[model samples]
Target: MTMVTPGSSPSPDPDLVQTILLSLRRKQGTWVAWAQGCQTLQQAKLTPQQIFEETGFEPIQQNQIVVAEQVYQSILKAGLSDKAQAHFDQRGSDLLYELRVLSQADRARVAEFTLKHGLEADEVRELVKPVKEYSYRKENPPGFGDGPGDAIAFHFWKLARQKDDLQDRSRLIAQGLRFADSDGARQQIETLLTDFTVVKEQPAPTLPLYRLETETDLPRIIPVVGQMPLTIDDLKAVPVAVPENPFGMVTFSGTGAWIAVPGWQVIFQSEDPVGLLTRARQLPNYPAEAADEPVLVIVDRANREWQDDGYFLVAQAEQLTMHWSPSPIDAPILGKVVLILRPKRILDEDYNRQPWQLDE
Candidate 1:
């Protein structure tokens, strides 16, 4: 009976870890105890796989329990009602896990709402997203308060207003009514449903499907150039490497080229366009053809509007380079990166070595 006080030491005692592992196999503890044991095992530098092999808990299950335990502790610290505390003393690990993304105060409030409604894990999962998003808003929308129901009502009300179709508006309004605690919140949604008149179907989304053949519908090839200051003539002089696939094979021969993707219509429309050859190793997590093989990154010189998620070409300290950011970079603008080319995987590399082994 090795005694281990939880959170007593940053580095857990080895004997305590062994005791917890043994207890886990016998199924002799609550989820909270198991969570603390898993956390202690992790603190002892045990890998998730090692812990999984020692105990029957999978990595994801271990993660859920650890996070759920943390959320439960926060709820307790926030001072829950006695009945609410009792209700969650042993159960609701999955529901609590879903509340991990929320703030401590919000977690406590949502916990009580969850218990009051007797919410299943799936419903709690759906409920948490709106509550988290509502907290980010600068001001609470009209007819909504700081309560959990108000957050959910605000979410449904916003959706109902966005929809032009009567069916969508009605459905969203119904959802608002189901969770809304205040009279003001319900009144606003009821008004919206009663006033529903016009109906417009959302436009069908277009599928990104393109047909490619050798001669007629071949992809345009854009050549990779060095990171140098470019003039209009240099942009014009660079040949648009049209596909020279003679025998049903696209061959990339001299001065590495990337087939122009149909998705780069914005790049095509640019007054001046050039491809920048970037070392794939330089970009984090980008797969490289070879360790030194530079890949073609197409940029549109005209489109320099800063989008948060977009990658851009910038000139800093007299050197042209690629930059990606949600915030503005303190550098002169060159172009917006529109396309990055990754070479197709060579699936027949083994076949090239062993010519007659087609049975594989």
Candidate 2:
């Protein structure tokens, strides 16, 4: 390892700079040597900025080369087959760079795998994630071998199990089958594909969006005894307050703000329903604009019993909040969150067309 001192050109050699610059320009099939050339220039007290000015190699590229070169060297020292060495000898710098995240031993194994599979740079990048994360998992996936291929297979197998759609699950299972090293792992994934059944998922209930109007039709409060005649200003002097409505209303402002929820759908088997007002952040998958807007979470107060597939409103810190658990909670269960009314985001065509309008 040569020590790099910034701006300390002890002995300036113009020929050496030109030679390295030309080699860097010849960017075909010699990135390993290019990395070494960059190091030589750095050792000669040249900064990465200076190298960039001379050779047009950016600072980030230089960093990738330096780190990747070290990883390549470690792979070489660990030893690879003659064919693997020959393949990596020319090109594959991007492929080797992606392997830097793995351990030295794992890097060697994956380097050979990359060579065997003829993997592209992007494929190598995807392959490194599972290999790097495999060690951190508490337990190894059953029926999978302890190889890089098995690691990839296990990764896809878990994802295949998590998917609800048959198409998505089948695609992931096929991916896992492609990388399954052991027959046991292959059989396990194949079983999922062979025994697949299409169970139609029930559609979620939709509710209409309503605005909370500020104006009220309630009668005005008057003093028990006042002046015989009162002026409009005198009446206006008294503060006005509207009584809270029995049903909650979630409001949204601005044009093109309509969620295309169909007719109101009945929820649960409750006779009476109560509504609570809260922000959209409490719910998952809310739109960015709707994050701050109020939402009416309708629930049945009578249905306080815990249901496996239901969301409940619970009291926490002396405040009402959602309880997302199957089992009973220590806090008081307010009700089941039956219908959530979210405002729709409908862009106005006229407003969107303004950006493309020609100047007058």
Candidate 3:
């Protein structure tokens, strides 16, 4: 792959790239929403240009710009040099994304937090605390409704697939849904849930097995993509970098591998769950595969996070019994872990996707 240096211009427009990406994402989301019956078209059949023109774009909050103005005013009041204000316009939005949530009332706490953790999202989150009224309340006040109704609607709609009985695809694609105010408004949601089938409930594994690997030819962590595992043989391992302090979140690629971290492992994945089990059976020192029913082998020993009787509600399964637990083997030198995947929503046959297989 060819490397492009910083500030180098590409042949294509950057704004166009962002627009195309945005449109594709919107199309995907809309298709999913239509399948689940969350959206209804506002108008009848229209041309492509009309659809684009009529599509609802959210009002620009200009939050970063507003915060930038406030900061500039504060800087002027402090009698800071003009040079400080010059860089503010370009860098102000960047600072707003990191530090805008800081409460003006808690200036002391904000200073302390910024001094310790720098101006980052984690610092902003750390500095902010729950409202006192909600913190230790025994019961919600009268007329206090549940938060995140829209989120609930979105999640439900995302996971569901349209029923075969439903026709008029174009209408669904264009119409805006009348949210549940009365029974008439709620009919679509009710119908969708009743007709749609969730697919993640069916996994290839019939049984969960706790197997003990007792061999010398140990399995190695293989890199499918470029991502390498964060390996650790020590339980008390500290992050190599000083910036990963307090409540910092480090986002990393989870390439399929038998990764050994201080507390967790990134197990291997396959195109199909059956293929994954098949490969695990072939590995030396790994336990033999189960007969008749396919088994998912989990090796557990010397790990503090292991829980035998626990279950987690995963996105695919959407049930409490579909939770995650550690593997059966925990040998740092001779153990490999198979990746466990959460269930994904089943989409319409017309809207199905295939994983891209690049040359190995």
The top-ranked prediction according to lDDT is 1
Give each model's whole-structure lDDT. Answer: 0.70, 0.67, 0.30
Can you write out model 3's per-residue Cα lDDT over 167-207, one digit (the tens) per residue? 43223312213211233323444555345453342222333
lDDT of 2 by residue, 141-225 (tens): 6787777888888888777877788889989999898877889889888878766654343332323335433223122333333
- Candidate 3 minimal-lDDT segment of 10 residues: 312-321
Superposed model 3: Cα runs more than 4 Å off: 1-61, 78-87, 97-118, 128-360
> What's the C-alpha lDDT at position 348 in model 2?
62
| Preferred candidate (lDDT higher): 1 or 3 | 1
Q: TM-score for each prediction?
A: 0.55, 0.50, 0.17
Q: Model 1: per-residue lDDT, tens digit, 1-360?
A: 012223545877789889989987777778888888888888787877788899988888888888888889988998799998887877889999888767788899999999888899999988887886576454667888888998999888877877888787888899999888889888877888667644343432221112333223334454656458977777776665555332122235455544444444655676767765555665433434545444566678987877656677765323365655434554556787666654433455465457464675
Q: Cα deviation in Å at residue 275, candidate 2?
A: 46
Instruction: Please give the TM-score that candidate 3 achieves against the real structure.
Output: 0.17
